[model samples]
Target chain A: MIVCIKQVPDTTDVKIDPEKGTLIREGVPSIVNPFDKNAVEAALKIREEKGGKVTVITMGPPQAVDALRECLAMGADDAILLSDRAFASSDTWATSYTLAMGIKKVGNPDIIFCGKQAIDGDTAQVGPGIAEHLGLPQVTYVQKIKEVKEDGMIVERSIEGGYEVVSVGMPVMIAVDKSINEPRFPTMMGTMKAHKKEIPTWGLAELGADEDKLGMNGSPTRVKRIFAPERKGQGEMIQGDDESEVCALLIEKLRDKKVV
Target chain B: MAVKIIAEECIGCESCIDACPFPGAIVMDDGIAKLTDKCNGCGACADACAVEAILVEETEVKSGIDINDYKGVWVFIEQRDNHIANVSLELICEGRKLANELGTELAGVVLGDGVEELTKYCFAYGADKAYLVDGPVFKDYRTDSYTDVIVEMINRYKPEVVLFGATNNGRDFAARIAVRVHAGLTADCTELGIDPETKQLMQTRPAFGGNIMATIICPNHRPQMATVRPKVMKKVEPDFTKTGEIIRVENSVKEEDVTTKILEIIEHATKMINLSEAEIIVSGGRGIGGPENYYLIENLAEVLGGAAGASRAAVDAGWVPHYRQVGQTGKTVAPKLYVACGISGAIQHLAGMQTSDVIVAINKDPEAPIFKVATFGIVGDIHKVVPLLTKKFKELKEAN
Candidate 1:
């Protein structure tokens, strides 16, 4: 089993200096994505049940090794990092293609698990795109892993309204949602073991990926522009002491706008 | 460009046969529609198909693409109880804008019983043309019946863009049509734009749980499809003098073919806090502490005569029902006044409520993102502020 993880800047905690529009990551700490923790937990559980190795893969800047180490401490058997300067600014399509090529180099496994979608990109496209690139069955928004069998696995998929139970053949890819399972804390012994474990780093050349499709050059979609949505018009504050009077004022305002 | 058809998987339901609007493009082959040379590669037939039989394949030329073969902006004018849904009207306003951008006509696809009078409303709302499909079978909102009639119209006249509301019925119909037509369908889009170069519809929406926004395009698919959330777009003001052509088509669905039954029509009594229809909302978050403090939220909501909402954290803490959660994982609300009490707005929570007309944040943390978006900020404890506000409102009412 191979679990893919990403180390995203803590966008929630980091403050952007209003004057410079630059992020302040100095005081902010990066934590594993809440959803990715579920993915790691799913992989660890599978490894424990099936007696196989769980390797964590990540493609990012050099600092992403910390995310891999966290995965290792969480009980992954091995950790691999795909770090290169050229990999920056990759869109979901390019990111998925690169990850797919790296997974190919790490020997085919019976299963692949990823967070339903990364917190930063939020495309949710990468997991499905990877499945399309790898030509394997993919189940997304998986809430529960009912059973893992030799030939296939049974899982419950989270649909819009409810859940559906599905069975897919082995060597399949599953993108899990946050509702899947609760992640466990890394033990002291496991943390010590991870500190001693040497992590192998791979580059684009070692992965043998098409350079054209591995970064911005390979992505078709472009972010033309991004700006905040326009704020609503000035609000009318109705001043009144009585409920009926306030209600009457609201009704009149709504009628003036013909919203009612 | 040539369109592909998956015949083996097709059920030969003839749903597509009735849906193809292009002349002589689709012919009956053992009750299933087959594409011929007359097919201009317009994808209305594929979208109208129900069993996922039709596939539209686009040919990539190094030079460019022709978008005029698919023209006009169409809004599915959904009606219930002889009244147009607010969402449908909202789409027409949006469609009118898109039509103007493309230098094309804006049209409305109205399908229901006694829909002739409804054409006037569509035109008044901004549609340049109205296509009506009226029959007794169309009186109710049934997926199969509605799909049959609408698909038949598309088979007759191909529209470039089709917009539907992201309501229950709209989503049900849109998904079935997109699958049948083999065209792309972008759901719950927050924004829409026309690619200046290709004249393609750029559908933008929050993907991966509101972490990021993605813009989707169906380069090859004809009649780029999308479903916009209600209240996300503004509805055009009705001009009573506006009028347009109403083309009525005969319905072909029989009562026997409908599989689902409308067992009962039970309407729940309107509640004081009708979140779906509320004009104002006062939401609380984890900072509210526990279930006991939810009373503070409820009291504030009651005084303001608004609905009470909770963040996902508060709801998951068992402090409130899941329906009250305001975030990416919950309902997206756009009310007149949104007061965030003790809610430190997470990105997910912001995605759901950021569109509120007026925002007021009351939190002890001055650095909260909710304060950034809020029109008015009170850096104080909600427990102290809410009670004060409630008491002030009461005193004001009594004095008046």
Candidate 2:
């Protein structure tokens, strides 16, 4: 089993500096993307039951080794960081292409796992993109693995109002949802071993990827601008002497809006 | 890929550090601004540079596709159980406006077994043309089969802009097609526009959990693809009198070629808690105190004839099921009336339901961010205020 992960700036860590009119970047901790952690947990569970080695891979900067180390501490057999200056500024298309190359270099596996989406980008495109590049069937938004078989497995994929049970063959890609499992904290022994582990860093040359399809040059989308969203105007506070009066006033207001 | 910072002009003011969205993307190395690998070339740091020390090289790479060949604005018409999904209709309504703005035709791309008759509904909604791919293999929504058909259709008759409903199935197949066709795809766009000068599709979406809004454009790609969540766009009233040109296409994908099989679909057995379709929603949060007190929320929702919802805190605490969660990680809802009880309105929570027509926040703390977006706010305990509101509404219904 191979699990894909990403390191992201914790969304809760993002804050705007009122005085500077800029993001307060200091003291913001970068953690493994929560959804990716869920994916790693799912992969670890499958390995525990199926008795196979789990390999974790990520394509990010050199600092992304920290994220892989954290995954290693969670009991992944091996960790690989595909880091290079050439892989910078990649959109989902290029990111997925690079990750797919890394996956091929790592060797064949019966199953591949990925998080539903990265919190930082929130595009949810990489999982499907990798599946397409590799020409593999994908079951996305998987909430649970109902039953595992030798050649195939039954998984519950989350849909609009509910979930659909799907039977898929091996060598398939599964993108997991947050509802799948509660990720475990790293044990002290595992943490020490993870610190001692030397994760291999693969670059574009190692992956044997085309330079024209590697980074910003290969990305189709471009950011025109990013700004703080305009704040909603101050809302009207319903004033009443008592809760009953407030409720009556609110009901009247709803009626005026034709909402009641 | 590199967002270069010219060290010769470095004033080391650290303005770029503050402006950079990614932490540790830019750092000061010996009183000179330096670029780290964390930079995704967003260019915010360059804009913030006072000394003009930062440079972002924007090299346009052509994907060998003629952009001029793509013309119409198309919405992928999604259906289940032989009924067209409301979100597809909503996109057709939106696509109509975009098509008008672009001076192009609006079309609907439908794929299903015997879904030929559904073209009339698409035409009624707003599409001027319908591309129908009918077959048994196209009945169920499978990633492989759907991507194979749609990618071929897109390559044959190029649409300048393709909009999907952002449903689970929508996101799944759309991503694959976008990658295969080498088109730029944006997810969960709240607003879309055409650049007046360049004629490019401008896609704006919330990032960092609604803390930032980024406008993206695919200048070099042929088809600009986007996925809009349900309830985010309005649908025009149907005009059954309208008719469209139906172009039937063949689906060559065989059942044996598809790798995954849908064994069963199990809808939640409980009362349908579809908050996106609900007119009103009453939600509780950390301030609701405990799981036992959740009945107040349900009672308020019942009295108002609405669905019950919960904040991430409440849902994370296991007080309520995940389906009833209303927030970024949960569901984005734009109801007529959203009553947030004790939900202090974290930015993530507000990102989901702040678009409601009427927002009522009931919390003991007056300074909660929920009040900022509320149409009516009560600075009182949910334990006391929720029941009173429920009682008052019950009495009003009885009197009526």
Candidate 3:
């Protein structure tokens, strides 16, 4: 089993670097994207049941080593970090292409798992994109795994009105939703051993990835512009000592707005 | 830069004539669409020419992927147990405009068991044609089977554009189909449009946690795909007198071909979720304090006959079920009246309910972000405020 994860800015602690006109990462904390952590949890469960090694991978800067170590503490057996200056600013398509090459180098596993989307990119394309690059069947938004048999697995997929159970053959890719399972806490022994476990960092040349498809050069989508959405204007505020007075004022205002 | 037309290859379909935004760009002379001075090398005509008779010289800007082989626009009409979803109808309505712009046919793809009868609504909503795949294997949307059906149709027909409602099923298979067909997919988009010059699908979605909006385009891939957020677009009024062609799609995918099976389906009671379509909504958050106080929010909704909603914090704290959560992670509602109590207006939460016609916020924090978007605000605790508001509304109702 192989799990893919990314290190993301903790949304709660993010601050913008006004001078640079970008998000400030100097002091802000980072964590494994919540969805990817869930993916790690799903991978750990499958490893426990099926008796296999869970190898995790990530593509990011050198500092992303912290993320790989954390996954090791969470029970992932091995971790790989694909760090290269060339990989910066890659959109989902290019990012997935680079990840697919890394997977090929690692040798194809029976199953691959990824979170539905990353909090930072919020573009759930890479998981599916990898499936396309690797030529494998995929299922997205999986809520639960019903059964894992000899050659395939049955899983429940959440839809609009109800859940549908679907089966797919092995050597498959899955993007799991949040409702799948609750993530486990890293054990004391695991945390103590995580640092001792050596993690490997791979670069573009080592992965034998084409330079054209590894970075901004290969990305098709472009951000023409970006700006914060303007906050709404001021509204009539009612503040008073008595809650009843405020409620009465609110009712009158709702009437004025023709809402009542 | 100039567009040249081949006389012998011209079919005189005149699709390029409609696709040209500039009046004199392409003119029909002797049954051939020819480029005039008005042609600025925008290249929209070349894409619209189904026969490939027109070409623009020295202005060839190729997308990363070849899009020349694709044609038509498709909407996936999502259905559950034979009941068609309203969002699917809205997509057909929206797809018609895009198709007509590109000089192509607009079609709806419907797949399910016993759903052939519901295909009529596709035409009522302006679909020029529809594809129906009916079988016991498609009784429920299995990701593998449904994906196979749609992927087969897309590969065979080669649609230039495909749209799906950002519902769970749509979100699930859309990503899969995008992968299998090697198409580019933009998810949970708030807006959809066509680039007049490039003829590429322009998909705009909220990014950076709803703090900024990003417009994305899959310029290189054929069959550009998007899953637009439900309720963001208005449904077109159905014309019952309208009719169109229904092509029965033959599918060989069988039960054995799929690996997943539904032992049972536990449906979340949907009567409350008509929350997205509700005209009025009264919602509560963590500030009301605990699950026990939730009735205060429910009481206000009941008195007004509106739906009850909750912020993610309230839902996460076990104060309410996830179905009632109103935020980026939950449901997006645009009611005529939205009364929010105790929420401080996280940007993700605001994105869900900000489109309501009337927004009223009640929170102890007077400076909460929710107040900025609110038409009216009250600085008071929800425990006291909600009950008073509910009582006052009841008295007013009795008087009326």
Candidate 4:
């Protein structure tokens, strides 16, 4: 099993001035998304139970190796980083295509696991887009993994009302929700092993990825602009001593507006 | 330009061929609807087809609406058991502001059985007009019945922007209506604005997991549709002196067409801590120590006359059930007063409760992120602070 993770600049760390919509990322630190940790944990648990190697993969700049190393320290057997200058500014479609190519390069695994969505981009399209690109069955928003059989797996999916149990054939893609599993903290032994282990880095050429289908050029959706929402009028706080008085006060205000 | 047909694994269903309202557009080929040039792309055929075998390509054509052409901004007034949901009233307040900005009127669409009395209340709140759809079929919310009535009114009146609360019933009804009318619908909007340049409704909402907000626009669609979350907006006061025109809408829905039967309506017993509807909420985190200490937090919440909540970490630790968890993975709450006891306030947790009117934090760690948004910060043991606050509240209540 191979799980792909991304390192995003901690949104809290990035200072944004409300008056001026600009991000100050100079001193901001990046971390593996907290949600993706659940995906890594799910993969490691499956590898332990099914006797398979869990390889972690990421596509980012050189600094992204830090994220892969963290995954290795969490008990992943191997880590791979897909980094190249050509892969910058890729949207959800391009990102999924690139990751799909990277997965193919690492020996077509039986299953792939990913976080439901990345925090920074907040587009839940990547996982579903990958499933569409690979022509594989997808089970999204999976809250629980009931069982993993030889041919398929059963999962509890979170829907609008409650939950639905679904069975999907293997060689499937899954976008795991945060409630799927609890990620374990890296131990001293794992950390030491991770320190000695080197993550193999791959580029577009190494993965045999199509240049046109690898980055912004391949993405269909383009964001024209990003701006903060216009604030509404100054709100009037209703005040009174009792519920009836408050209700009366509200009624008075509404009478003025002709709204009963 | 040629229209593209994206076939989604058709099972040779002839429903589309029989249901295409347009003449000669669809023909039966291999027991499936094969498209021809006569297809007008009106999508009535798609709606009638049970198999979902038809797809229509929409072109991005800009339609200009004269600023003075539209008269009023209306909100769908949703009610349960004859009483208005807080969200509907909240949207009316919001719609009033938008109507004022556009120099127009604000109206509320009230559809129910014997809800004529609610029309006066709508005018008292902020509505300049109340469109009432009263009938027995419209008594309980059924998807097809409500959609048909609402769509009929929208087609006749042609309001500029329509808003719905993002509740289960609201979303279901709104999605069906939007699909029926071939209009763009933005769901779970947190913010709404009018573009000064284009007069377009800018609908903003948390896209992923409250990680980033995206603003959407429907330039070509008539009567722009948006579904706002409950508690994200304020409800205005009702004024009896204010008056509006009460327009009675006759419903044409027959009892037989409604296939779903309501066997029995059994409402669940009210929860002790209804966090979603609470005006004030006091939540505990993992730092509360264990499940046993949750009682201290609950006691404080009771004294404050508020509901108790828990962080995802505490909930996952078996300290509380998942419903009480407040974060991206759990429920989003915005209350008048939010007290965080021992919460570290991760970004995900903040996403849920950052919109509270007033936040008070009590954590042992002085550097905890919860303090950043806390109006009152106490760096001490929650066990100590909670008990002290509970006792103080009791004394204050007794003195009063």
Candidate 5:
């Protein structure tokens, strides 16, 4: 099984500087995307039960090797990082193309796994994009794996109202949700081995990816501008000496609006 | 393509450093901006450059698809159990406006079994044309079958813009179709507009947990696609008197082509608490203290005849089920009334339900960001304010 992951800025740890009206990213640390961990954990669980190898991959800068190492420490069999200056500034389309090429170079695998979405971007496009590029069946937002057969597996997919039990064949791609499984912590021995394990970094040339579909030039979407959303306005603060008075005032105000 | 900082035009201003969302993508070197490998060609720095020092040079990769060939705005009318999804109607309403601005027709594309009657609702919601692909193979939403039919339709009749609701099934299949058709798709877009200058579809969505909003455009790709946020767009009242052309397309999707099979579907037994369809919601957060105190939130919701919700923190603490959680990772709700009790509104949580018509925040902390968006704020203990509000609301009902 091949699992795709991304290293993202811990958005929860990010803070806004009120005085400067800018993001205070100085102290904020980067971590493996929370949802991606669930993907890694799902892959590991399947490999443990089905007796196979789990390979983890990511496409980012040199620092992304840390994310790979963290996945390795979680007992993945191997890790690959696709990093190059040419691969910079890729949107979802380009990113998926590059990763699919990297997966092709890794050889055929029964199942490919990924997180539902990354916190930083929250696009949830890469997994399906990769599946299309690889010509594999895709099942997204998988909540649980019910039973594994020789040629296929039964999984529960989360929908709007409830869950749908789906039976998918092998050589398929699945993006897991956070409810899938609890990721395990790295053991001391696993950490030591992960630090020692050599992770090969693949570039555009190594992956045999077309340069036309590699980076910013390959991306179809372009960001015109990005800014903080404007706050609506300050709300009316219902103040009173006691809870009873405030509650009464609130009720009266809502009654006037007919929302109560 | 790569981002380059032209030293000749450099003014030593650091606006680019602040505007770039990717960490370590830009840094100051010798009083001038420099680009690192961390940059993901989003071109935010170039926009932020005061002196226009940053330049993004594309390698002139032609997509080979003629953008002019694509016309009209199409919305994928997602339906389940023969009932049209509300988000689909919402998109058709928005699509009518976009189609008008572009001087093109708005079409609703529906693919399902025995769903031809849904076409009338599409016309009522403002679609000028309806394309229906009805068959047994299209009975359920399987990615393979849905992608095949949708991709075929898109290829046959090119659309300049295709919109889908950013629901689980919509996102699941839209991504696949976008890739197959080589179209640019923006996910969970909160706003959609046509660029006045370029006349291209502009997709605007939140990034970095709603802290920043980015406006995106697909300049070179045809059929600019986006999965719109569920409740962000307003749906106009349906005009049943309106009529449209119904074009029934033959489905070529075979059962053998679908690799995944739906064994069973388990609908939520307690569907009454469906937050997305609720008119009012009372949500608790970390401030609710513990799971034992959750009844206060439930009681208030019960008194209001609405749904009980919880913040991500409350859900993470195992106080509530994930289904009842409200936030970016949870549900995006636009209820008529939203009462946030003890919920310190993080931007993530606000991204989910800030679109509610009326927001009432009850928190002890006056400085919480929840107050910024709340229509009514009460700086008091939720334990005290909640019970009193419940009692008072009940008394008002009794008096009436």
Candidate 6:
């Protein structure tokens, strides 16, 4: 089993660098994407039950090694970091292509997993894009996996209306949501084990990915503009002498607005 | 320049037929592709034309892309159990305006079994034409089947732009088709407009943790795709008397060919909460305190004849169920009246309910972000104020 992860800037109160039209990452704390943590837990759970090696991979800058080390502490047996300057500025399309080629280099696996969407891009395209690239079946927004049979697995996929239980064949790729499982905290012993383990690193040449499909030059989509949206006009603030008076006034207003 | 399909080099792979999005552009003759008059020289078939058989005249090419070749704006009309999605109608309203602004036709593309009868609603709403692809393969929303058909349809009759509601199914399968067709798709957009100067679609959506809104444009892609959030766009009034043309497109994907199977649909929540359709909602936050105090919210909702809503904080804390959670990760509700009690209003929570027609916020802290969008705000203790407000509303209702 292989789980793909990404390291994203913690965006609770992130600010944009208006001049460069980019996120101000200078002092912003970075963490493994919340959704990717859920996926890592899912992959580890599958390995625990199904009895297989869990190999996690991520494609990002050299600093992404920290994210892989965290996954290692989470019980993943191995970590592969695909880092290269040539891969910078890749969109979801190029990212998926590069990840697919990188995964293929590690050898074919029974299953692949990734977060439903990344916080920075919020595109949720890479998992399905990789599936298309590798010709594997896919399921997204998975809430629960009921069972993993020898040939196929049954999963409850979350939809807007409800959830549908789907049985997809093995060799399928799934993008998991937070509802799938709660990620566990790393223990000190686990941290020590991860620190002692060697993490392998690969690049475009090692993955043998086509150069045209690795970065901005290969990305089909481009960011035309990025800025803060203008705030709307202010709304009214009504106060009253007392609670009943306020409720009465609010009721009158609701009646005027045809709301109650 | 016109597209030429060389019959001899064509290996009868049907790749061209599947790749062409324009209807009537290519047809299978003796298992070989035959180009028809409907071909607009978009040359989408070039990559999939396998054998390098399909050729286009080079004189009119601009950077190897013919932008003028594609025309029309399309709205994906998603339906389930014979009910057309309201988001589809909303998208139709938006798509109709874009099509007019672009001087092109607006069509609603419906894909499902026995859904042909619902195509008239597309016209009643605003679509100039309806593209109906009917079959049992669409009985269930399978990623592989839907992606195959939609991608093939885009390749056949290349619509300049396609709009999909950012519902679960829409968000699920849209990227797959976009990736397959190599088109650009914007996700969960809150606003859609046309860039008058460049003749491009301006797709705006709240991003970066909903702190800022970014307007994305697909400058070079032929068919620009965007998935709009539900209830964000205006729902046009239906014109019952109006009728439109219905064109049936063929999709050869089979059920047995798909690798996924639906064992059953497990609807854990028996009753569906139509928060989007609710006129009034009384939502509580973590400050509402515990599960015991939930009855205060329920009583208030009962007095006002409104549904109960909760903040993600409260839901995560298990004060109320997740279905009632109104936030970015939860449902987006645009009720006529949204009363926020004790909700300190994180941006994620505000993104879901800020669009309400009238927002009344009651918080102990005056600096709560929810007050920014509220029509009325009361800074006070909810424990004392909620019970008093419930009693007053009950009295007012008795008098009315």
Measured by TM-score, the strongest candidate is: 5
The clash count for each model shown is 10, 0, 4, 13, 2, 9
- Looking at model 6, residue B360 earns an lDDT score of 88
- Candidate 4 CAPRI classification by DockQ: incorrect
**lDDT digits (tens) for residues B127-170 of candidate 4:** 99999999878886655567778888887788888899875456
Summing lDDT over every window of 10 consecutive residues in candidate 6 chain A, give the lowest-scoring window.
A16-25
Most accurate candidate by DockQ: 5
Identify the runs in model 1 with alpha carbons over 4 angstroms from their true place.
A20-29, A84-88, A107-110, A146-171, A227-260, B1-96, B104-189, B195-230, B235-281, B295-308, B312-333, B346-348, B362-372, B376-400
Q: Any idea how many clashes model 3 has?
A: 4
Q: Write the per-residue lDDT of candidate 3 for residues B31-92, one digit (tens) a residue.
A: 87777754445466777788888876642224455578899999998887788877788788
- Model 4, C-alpha of B307: deviation from truth (Å): 1.6
Every candidate's lDDT: 0.71, 0.87, 0.79, 0.71, 0.88, 0.81
Error of 4 at B215 (Å): 4.7
Once superposed on the true structure, which residue ranges of model 3 sit more than 4 Å away at CA? A15-26, A46-50, A107-110, A131-139, A144-156, A165-172, A205-220, A238-260, B1-66, B274-281, B302-307, B331-337, B351-357, B392-400
Docking quality tier of candidate 3? acceptable
TM-score per candidate, chains pooled: 0.61, 0.93, 0.81, 0.57, 0.94, 0.85
Question: What tens digits encode model 6's per-residue C-alpha lDDT throughout B1-400?
Answer: 3478887898988877655644467888988899885554546677676699988753321224576777999999888777888889999999999998898999999999999888888999888899988898887788899888888888889899999888777877777777777677888888888988889898887776665666776766678888887777888779978899999998889888998988887654533355655668889998888988988887888787777889989988978876677876567777778999999988678767887878988898988878877888888888988898888888888988
User: What is each model's TM-score for chain A?
Assistant: 0.87, 0.96, 0.91, 0.90, 0.96, 0.92
Residues A15-93 of candidate 4 have per-residue lDDT tens digits of 5445443344457788998768889999988988988999999989898999988888999999999999778656565
Scored by TM against the true chain B, the candidates give 0.75, 0.87, 0.79, 0.77, 0.91, 0.79
For A112-179, candidate 6 gives per-residue lDDT tens digits of 99998877666677888888888889999898989999998999987765678999998989898767
- The Cα RMSD across the true interface for model 3 is 8.4
True contacts kept of each: 0.04, 0.71, 0.50, 0.05, 0.76, 0.51
DockQ of each: 0.04, 0.61, 0.29, 0.04, 0.64, 0.28
Q: Over the stretch A1-260, how does candidate 1's per-residue lDDT look in tens digits?
A: 88888887655564443433223345677777667788999999887888898988988877888988888898999989997655655656567778888888888978888886565544455665566567666667777898898977888764323345666777888888766777889999999999999998888778877776665455433433222234334334444564444444544554465333
**List of clashing residue pairs for candidate 6:** B20-B155, B20-B156, B21-B153, B21-B154, B21-B155, B21-B156, B21-B157, B22-B156, B22-B157
Instruction: Give candidate 4's TM-score.
Output: 0.57
Pitting candidate 3 against candidate 5, the one with the higher TM-score is 5
Error of 5 at A113 (Å): 1.3
